[model samples]
Target: MSAIELEKDGGLWTVTLNRPDKANSLTRAMLEELADIAEAAVDARVLILTGRGRVFSAGADLDEAKAGLALSPVWERLSGAIAALPGLSIAALNGTLAGGAMGMALACDLRIAVPGAKFFYPVMKLGFLPQPSDPARMAALVGPSRAKLILMGGQKIEAPEALQMGLVDRIVEGEALLDTARGIAADTLTAKPEIATGIKRLCQG
Candidate 1:
């Protein structure tokens, strides 16, 4: 099966991280596929990113790290693609989010996660810089103080704390996570397209 899956319903497109056995850790192939999906989703009015199982993404595949391959460039490209989407972007984090994958989530306009989900960015503790786009995006979402707590302090923030810190927009439990995201997407449809797109781009910056 593919490491990434794309499903479209009308103008809503969902991009799923499908490597459940590996906690949806990203591989080169997966990153490439995601970038392609993002690039090809111009017709989508709303894009939702989520994981297939209990974990959103554990970040880069350690095998790639061990092989001495540079994954930063690929991550940069992928995050940039998601950020550049003309319409609204939503991240439906079904479970925990950590490491490099946090960048992709931060790129989204809104983040809705399950109650069991946790958020962490451990790059500094792992002795590496996060993807270039991560820090600013993280700071934008939760402010510089909270961003430092996660990125530099390597704090493991649970759902409640995450919501308090503004790391996640909403915490809906179980199947309600996706349902709520779809509802938000439907609400966005009521806005004027050009106005919504313009406001979205402005907020993204």
Candidate 2:
């Protein structure tokens, strides 16, 4: 099966991370596929990123990392592709999102996560530095102090705490996560394309 799955429902397109057995960990092939999908999805009115199982993504595959592969550049390209998408972007976080996987959610314009979902950034613990742009982007949403607590202190933020810190835009109950995301996607699709794009551009700038 493909590592990523794409589906279009009206104007909303969903890109799902499908490697459930690995907690949806990202591999080089998956990263390339994600970038390609994001680039091709610009025409959709909204794009929702989600995962198939209890973990949104476990981050880069360890085997790839141990073999001397640098995944940050690939992640940067994927995040950039998502950010540049003209359509409204939403990260429908299904469960745990950790390490480099945080970048995917950060790149989205909006985020809706299940109540028990967890967010973690362990680059410091892993003896790696986050991409230069990551800290700034996170700080923009949750201020510099909290960003440092997360990145430097390696604190794990649960959904409620994440909501309070503005790391996630909204919190929905377990089974209702995708529905809430679809509702938001519907709202975004209702707006004029140019207006939505302009608002996103304004907010990001």
Candidate 1 C-alpha lDDT tens digits along 42-82: 66789999999999999889898656433448788888988
TM-scores vs. true structure, each candidate: 0.94, 0.95
- The stretch of ten residues in a row with the least summed lDDT in candidate 2 is 65-74
Task: Assess candidate 1 and give its lDDT.
Answer: 0.86
Steric clashes per prediction:
0, 0
TM-score of 1: 0.94
lDDT of 2 by residue, 82-149 (tens): 87899889999999999888887898889889988999889888888886667887998899999999
- Deviation in angstroms for 142 in model 1? 1.4
For TM-score, the strongest prediction is 2
Among these predictions, the greatest lDDT belongs to 2
After the best TM-score superposition of candidate 2, give how far the Cα of residue 20 lies from its true spot, in angstroms. 1.0
